[model samples]
Target: MECTGEQFCSIIMDNMVEECVMVSILEPMGVVTKKVKGTFEQIGSPQQYSLCDHHQKSLVYCHRTMELKAVTIQGGNNRRARFNLSRYSNASTTTTNQALPVVLGIDQWNLSCSKQTDSATPVLQLERCKDQLTTIGAQEKTVRFLFYKNTTGFSLTTFESAMYPGWFISTSLEPSQPIQMCQKQDARKLINFMVKH
Candidate 1:
């Protein structure tokens, strides 16, 4: 099915406790990476997005921290010879001014939280260089996941972290356990959603 870039999306986990993904808000501003049942509204025009919930609360949009750059080696023995290296370089990373994701009526509006202050948010960033969506900072070793077509069926899609390719996003009943990357020999993480929209 084709999306018009304005449809609400539900990121459902195949084996999560709540069976939905949510932008959880906790004290000190914490984002729940674990999957929970949630109704996410897709915001932003064109292809860019800022997710919103049923209560009109928009999810935090974590901007790109560092950008990849190709730097050429200086002082080469041969004038015609040059070496190239791809690396992450610090850049101007900022977040949107929209209010962070809140459960509405539960937590009051918070204005103190800011990306500049290093507060946590529910927005996950997709790093184009490595082709991974990172929940944490855009560090190389941070918790990063990859989106790909389902192995069994080409039409469906799923998320799998590069660190743990064998495991897919899953959830547990316990709050301590929450949702996590789980490994199942016969399981497939494939699901349908408008990733671009």
Candidate 2:
């Protein structure tokens, strides 16, 4: 049940989702290749064993079919203060939209296609601000999802490094109900499930 940081990072980098049971994960980047049968003359050469042009087309087709499912969760603590002064009769009135403003966050997230050579499962931990009741006033609020090795409990800096140029957010739900960190497979499944029900 426990895994080291190195082992965990390898799994995440490799895009292996089924190793972890609690969470259902999917990688859109997992490309499937097919062998093309043809003579050296018909094809190009035996030395080139990579997927044929047709095979590459098919792989791309398959990858596009299993991309991430679209999910939108909206909830943010934002407060606005307004003041109005009237010149006549010294009467002034102010109005405020006290409701918690919701923003469309995490429209889509895809899984990595790379495979993991190691056998460790990756766990994602979300960190949020401590002051939940108070509005996030004037300061930028950030949510961080940390991928850690379950056994060693060490952070995978390499995995973090690989995630550059991509956007992610932290979830406030329990580990089992981590809607924020839904993997590609689970996201698709959940979307389908929601549609059916």
Candidate 3:
């Protein structure tokens, strides 16, 4: 597909799909590495995003703590560039308001959560870059994220690990606390975030 200035496209996997757009390179965008037809193509480009926590206000990366933290943001804060987002390609037949596959990144690193260990809840962390939606046979990557959107007239979204479906990315109500995963039925309001593209 022709991507010209923020088109609605989903690159769910490493390979291309029918509904997926070409925006491959995440860090530095607009520099086409390969030649498709002696022209430049937008390959793997990542759009900088700021996730607003419903309760804590701001979801940011704590450089000192080396992890994501929840705090107050006034006037968009100064850490918007710390996070980036891209949608994973989904080839579903029906176009319901269902959760779409996506990949969350902290700059160049991709967000990932391991499967529950010893029945313990999984925590979200940034790891080396990889196409999370890339699957082999029946095995899906742990780096994949499920993007859930709430259509209650507000742009609220939640990121759940594809490895574990019900678990979501959450933050603490108290400021400066680390961000982790929580259950859907949890009474906390931190899971729902307003994704500012």
Q: Per-residue alpha-carbon lDDT of model 1 for 82-144, expressed as tens digits?
A: 111111211222212221221111011111111223633222232333322212233333323
After TM-score superposition, the amount by which residue 72's alpha carbon in candidate 1 deviates from its true location, in angstroms, is 51
How much lDDT does candidate 1 score?
Answer: 0.24
Better of 1 and 3 by TM-score: 3
Task: Give the alpha-carbon lDDT of every model.
Answer: 0.24, 0.21, 0.56
Ranked by lDDT, the better of candidates 1 and 2 is: 1
Q: State the lDDT at 153 in candidate 2.
A: 17
Superposition TM-score, candidate 1 onto the true structure: 0.23
Clashes of 3: 10
> What tens-digit string does per-residue lDDT give for candidate 2 at 64-117?
332222222234211111111101110111111111111111112222211234
List ranges where model 3 is wrong by over 4 Å. Answer: 1-44, 74-76, 92-96, 130-138, 142-152
lDDT of residue 8 for candidate 2 = 97
Better of 2 and 3 by TM-score: 3
Name model 1 segments beyond 4 Å from true: 1-139, 142-155, 171-177, 186-196
Give the C-alpha miss distance for residue 156 in model 2, angstroms. Answer: 26
Clashing pairs in 3: 11-89, 12-88, 12-89, 23-43, 23-44, 23-45, 24-43, 24-44, 25-43, 25-44
Pairs of residues at least 3 apart in sequence or in different chains that clash in candidate 1: 20-36, 20-37
TM-score versus the correct structure, for each prediction: 0.23, 0.16, 0.63
